[model samples]
Target chain A: MPITRRRLLTAGGGLALAGATAAACGSNTGRGGGGSGGSLSHWYHQYGEPGTEQAVRRYAAAYKKTRISVQWRPGGNFDQQTAAALLSGSGPDVFEVNGPTLDQILGGQVVDLTDLLKDVKDDFQQAVLAPKTHDGRIWGIPQTVDTQLLYYRKSLLDKAGVRPPRTLDELVDAARRLTDRRTKGLFLGNDGGAGVLGATPLHAAGLSPVTADGKVGFDDPAAARTLAKIRKLYEDKALLLGAPADWSDPSAFVQGLTAMQWSGLWALPQITKALGDDVGVLPFPADGPAGKPAVPVGAYAAAVSARSDRKAEAKAYVRWLWVEQTGYQEDFALSYGLHLPARTSLARKADRLRQGPAAEASRFAAEHGHADPLLWTVASKVAYQDALSRIIKDGADPEGQLKAVVRTTEAELARVRKRS
Target chain B: MPPAALRPLTSNTTRRQRNRTLWFWVFVGPFAVGLALFTYVPLGWSVFLSFFDAHNTVTPTDFTGFGNYRRILSDPEFRSSLTTFAVFTAIIVPATFALSLALALAVNRLRWAQAFFRSVFFLPTACSYVVAALVWKMSIFNGVRFGLANTVLGWFGAEPVAWLATTQPPWYWLVIGTVRLWLQTGFYMILFLAGLQRIPVRLYEAAALDGARPGWQTFRHITFPALRATSVAVALLLVINAFQAFDEFFNLLSDARGYPPYARPPLVYLYYTALGQGQDLGLGSAGAVVLALVIAVVTVVQARWSGLGRKEE
Candidate 1:
């Protein structure tokens, strides 16, 4: 028998109603049981190639006693998925939150993790924990920490007859000498926005856009100087216009088209895959006359949904995956060969990371890195992007653009504060 | 004599009429309820929300009366978005209409394997927008040398163009328009083909017998009035889709934050305002309400201009 639209509608409505009723009744089949140790649902962003799925299932099987079911959803537009789930109160119990938006998510409905990780909190990197904490209340546990590093094609550098730059002046001179009309010494597409523009340069210059107090601190003279250097690079044709910071893939460095690419440690695997053993990693050049090289520190956070009824189980699962068994570090190395453990202790203990180039880069990034603290605000992302676009597309003055961004951000912060 | 003069009233006719009316209502009732629940109810809610400062995320707190609408009126971003939206609609609507009509006419002339040809044309409409966008972004319209479009361009001695990365506005618009055409033209073509079939062949034959050429005949009668209704429907649909253009732009462009100069369609901006950055539900809802009104007005204007609702005399 052919189904009519009316019949379909009736069936759908009836099913939805029944589902709602069942949900309200706290159906044990789907819903996690907290203290009784039933099934726990853990959602994570997908990673690795084809073999990664097998590794994840193996990891899940190893931790079967936790009764946790790991559902790895591919990481593309995760915010939309999370938002929809949050509204319907059916979001994953445990999920990933970006470093910058850590506080905002926490403020909304994120479960507090202060008491949950009281004993083990200090064991993790302070930088990782900083963004996840608000008013001394821990809202999330760090899963992985990332930091920006300069990726160079060793063969390209050698072919160009230039050594890696040790100082800012030396770097500029090297870039100038190395650059030709067909190829650039450095490739950055900062036209997309401020985050892309600011991330590498600000870190290299030893400046932070946001301070510990969640205030706008991006208007530093050092930041201006860095922007000036970028402008000079563009003027000299030392940087590729084709690979605008907004749209250019960092993989250009791996593809041997560019001499240097400034990105995070995550690109190591990709670079390794593309260029094989011909890539060399280095920290971005130091800003001051005699400062150490620096990179921007970024962390991925894991948090329990505020709407989740199985908060305890979710927290327990996070502790297990991220803290207890060193599962996160293992997964990071074995699965994607991308991430570094957020916990310093775990990084030291993980044999897989210690034996690879990823470990070396992670350790370098961690010791000398800056993290953006203005992540909790909406204006930061937009303002950052707009500032970059203005600078690249309209040839707007960097100082003026940065100041505008700060002004806009300050106003947004005030508005949000007032609303609260 | 009085009983004979008084004719017996037939109850069967009245009973049959009552049954037909009941059946008609039964069919209409489901749709009426659906319309009330999904359309009118949400629309009413949206209009109500527009009066206050309503956010789309968290719990909407502030209730500044007409604050959102006033802000929207003065906002440069909103003005730019409206302009962008208008340009996008204007380009896509007429281009899609002409292309679909041409395709329909071509397909209608085919005798052998008509169904296969029709299916081939409509295949893109069935593909998910996400899949299509990804494929277009990665493979076909790839900005790099590896892309199919660039490979074809290479044959003509042209360098690979960064379709997504270029600061050039016209190129960006062209790329977006091409994708939209690829996805939407097929569905509209089928609609036009159906309308073409409904056009009486006798009229064309009569026009031909009158010594009128094929193109002239089509221009005079067969093509003009026959496509009027389909054009109106397609125009309205295109306008609605243009305003609601999010999935392709969002997926293909922008980062995790959904920031500007990429996918920041007004709806995307509204979405970001609500969920991405501010978590402000009020501003987003207010933006949505404004967008709805804009779409409604545009669609109504098009429908009126096209004489979509006018009955044949």
Candidate 2:
């Protein structure tokens, strides 16, 4: 039909009304929808796995005590978004955190979940709880555990006649020998070795980023020596400088862009699907006799906002979903992406994780896994990463850079100490 | 006091005046309130936050006067960001100005299909900077061998280059510069086209009558002199925009790992300072205030140099 002005205006108004109604309904998710216990809002960073969003939504739907709406945030900057949201007081009533931040602990942003997990606290590992605990109070319940280690191709290493690296020096030499026109020897990340290797070398050197006294521990000569070795690897052009995908994903390794890649255990499913029996796993190599190999533990946890009006309901949901609901937890961890269940009992029972590369990765994690110290604030990490970038990418003096980063870390630690 | 008929007319006039005044406020009231609420209020809040140690929270009780400013000013990373902004502006402003003027001049000389060419050239202006930057990063300048740039390089028997690597060779500048130029030049060209249309045809005819050539001499004398105001305005815009460059820089450079230290503009640095993992809003706000002041001073200096508001003499 030929449109007239009145008809057009009427249609536009109708569409606007519909849009307004839909938006009102969407925003009302946080409020009760005939539920007696009220409603809660929960946020999760968009997981890369296919079925994670549907799974979380399903779990939220299953909770009978309170109605919950899931807001799946997509982007690499979920932390920044969450920080802004919490500061504005419009944040989710329940949310996911990789580890409880210092501000979250000291500023009273996160509710203490210690009492919620009191009965089953023993099921969770101490290493997993260390980052979430502040002053002996657990701020979050562990949702899933991820471990980062090196993934190499068995076939490629055999062809090159290079065994798995057992030390930092040997790792660098292997990277050089394995590099060719077709592929690079190693992939630490697109930013040379700045990001994925930031804490790895420190762990390999038997050093913590922040010491028990809240002082910088990475400025020691051992840390500097390890970083310099990585720099030499970078200068040899044996490490992958830039790839379409970063080290977090196994795309660089599976696609033959790099022979060996530093990645997480979550990528194992995809790597095995692509490379079949050709893949192998190893922890980051040791730097010297004083040092031991280490696999860094990365995890996600669930927490309730202290300012949430539905704190009781939110805590109930966290307890129900993350703590009590083992079946859902196992599915959430294993179904979409391959990850270790937060509970040691669940991990021990999983048949898929009992053999092959998965078994080896779990063994390494159990033996040599390291998590960031309580005092390792984001400021210190940023400073250390910046220095690492300069050293590896720009060939800056590692000793001088580490010294400067120590000053920055010390200042950050002082702030944390003052706040606490 | 004068007459009965005159008094009624006076009342009618008063009523009309009242109606107009009511309508005036009705038109402008929401806009005024919106400006105050969204722009001015936040600006004032930012300045206030800069004076306090507002980390992770907007409402901070701890006041530290000039400490945030001093910290940001002393920061070498912040200082280098300023230099990055300077380098970006120095390259982009001139490059955009010349390219847009050239496009406008070429489009003006077209006898047929002028509208088609104009629309075609101006289409990219409608694209979002974030989307454009992504296309440039992922498809064109990606480091993989199958990327568009590398594919073309491979045709010429050259090794694939990591275009975004900030180590030794700064090919990232080329990638960033080209994307901005493509996105911005079309809009400026439209502005220049408007200026070109307003230029009196009689002047060109007069120059021709005075035995002037049609190509370079005519353009150098007549066209260049006439576009002074347009050039100044476009240059002013380009300079301000160059300072506010964030979307492309942030999206193109920032990865899951975090932003690289190199090629960080002032806005990106301030964004990281205020909002990134550290959550130092006070220092970020201070950096923001400093950046705004710098932009203002530069705009004023350029406006004065170009004699923007002075009567043409």
Candidate 3:
């Protein structure tokens, strides 16, 4: 008999031994189905909200014809565990990826969902489409989009007599103005985003981290200028180093820890609840002569397992859930949490997203949002972050840092080619 | 009489020996099964996987002998991680031993409520490593001005320090190091306490009668030599635990997104390579195999130095 996901999970192997307690705690392993023609398995990372799990199970249950087993894995180890399952030949038939990576595509682990997506393909925002497309084939169906931008306190900026920053220079000036013994201005992350926004600044400089053609594209001198600017901000005491929490939670912003914070759209509701009409959002300030304001848009997309024997069935389920059923998709996005549905028409219908800063953020995400290339490996990503750390924090030469990053990225691209 | 002669001397011995063999396996069965399944099997698989180029991580179809090992051996990050772990081990082992030994000595001489003091110290040992690390990361050593460490420092006319973020001054090491020391020292103290109790009261009496002092001289001559086996065992345990450090580093040193490479030990580095954004299992396994080898060599040297396996009279 072929090894099924259940046998591999329940048999107490390595994953079972390691993550079994986490699995037993929140996972819905008993979702009433196996791989019959209408049966499929799906997996999701843990969402902290109370009802998110039930919402997913309810969505899966609506398709009475198909028996879909949903596994809500705990967050930290989800990616690793999913990779292990996929490699073990016992992966979920249909699953979600944060974004399409080159390894998934080259491993042939994900199927091209484009053929079935023709009907509703155009309705997806540009932010959702660019990252999922590799070699002109759409690897995943964008479920909902997540965008990170600057959330500023209007009261604090007004008190400092500073207008909302529109450029990198303006941001630095505003940050210094807002800085005092009481509060700092901006909080990117705990590590000053040494790893997080290393490539994002490149995006703001009208540069992408790397090209899909296997060339280093973020080596521009403008990126160096951006790094230098960040260092100046650091020297001015315009940044918060450590907070009680990371940037993902709205607590830092809500608790008045900083004048402004860089965070995702998911935290919008909590921030709004704490300080009504006091909060405003802006895309990361553009840099360089060629630069434009931008938001880095990432999404969890639904894709079929290429190795699944029921690839056709899995593809149909993916289409039915993410594309065909707009109501469930809308509910999946808006009802559970503050997320923009992948479909443009659906996002337009979200009342909370239709007005004020929400509308502006939505528009900015669609227009200025950038996607990571499929071929960029995790090692290259870490290298980019390290390069930024060396340049901005350690005062190392920017050109040298870029060259080191370039060398590693080229090796990663070569590795992809060899694997493919 | 002819049948008895034909049966020979082997018949009874064979039956008895077979029964004893069967009983031996029966008694040791669960332990053997658990060891094979959890420990040895994964080890064998990791060694096997080190020879293959695996993408999915589980199924290794491509046989590239020694390629994975060669890749990890040359990687600068892997080498840096080893050096970091070496420093971490050096600090933790002696520190843990000294703290535990001191606590054990004090508790051994206690005239009343000895159990209370012992229980209080050992409470943290019973706490989970992840939970303890998180408590330290969030409550005590958090980078805010109001955090426990910073609050105390502020009273001294010093500005609040970013205890976890000051990488240049290496303040983060104190955060990670102190939490580990607090969590583990108590358990080792218990071991030392057991060893302390085993020393004969008559020996101390005799040393005193011979004009030996009640403090340093007596401890050096009597207590120290008497706990040799326990000290060796404790040191070995400390070395192994230090090398395998993961839970504390991961929980304390990482942000919500992921860990920075500033203070990762070998296990955490291998985890990222294998399971973190890049699922390069072959390379990760190779790194693991190499780490296991390092740990094994260190353990063997330590054991030999301590005379761990030698027969004691």
Best by lDDT: 2
Per-prediction DockQ, in order?
Answer: 0.28, 0.65, 0.52
Q: What tens digits encode model 1's per-residue C-alpha lDDT throughout A240-261?
A: 4333222224556755556876
i-RMSD of all predictions: 4.2, 1.4, 2.0
**Alpha-carbon shift of residue A82 in model 3 (angstroms):** 1.6
In candidate 3, which residue pairs clash? Answer: none
TM-score of 3: 0.91
What is the Cα-based lDDT of residue B66 in candidate 2?
A: 99
Worst 10 residues of 2 chain A by lDDT: A28-37
Put down candidate 2 lDDT per residue, B1-313, tens digits, no spaces.
6885666566788898898887676556656877998999989999999999888878888899999999999999999999999999999999999999999999999999999999988999999999999999888988878889999999998977888875588888998999999999999999999999999999999999999999999989999889988998999899988988999998788877678888999889888889986788899999999988998898889889899989878
Docking verdict class for candidate 1? acceptable
Candidate 1: stretches off by over 4 Å: A1-38, A49-66, A99-108, A166-198, A220-225, A228-258, A269-277, A286-294, A326-338, A349-360, A374-376, A393-400, B1-58, B106-120, B196-226, B257-263
Ranked by DockQ from best down, the candidates are 2, 3, 1
As a whole number from 0 to 100, the lDDT of residue B2 in candidate 3 is 72
What lDDT score goes with residue B33 in model 1?
Answer: 78
Report the number of the highest-DockQ candidate: 2
lDDT per residue, candidate 2, A68-165, as tens digits? 88989899988888777778556788989876788768877789888998899889866777889888899988888888889999899999999999
TM-score of each: 0.82, 0.94, 0.91
- Ten contiguous residues minimizing lDDT sum, candidate 3 chain B: B22-31
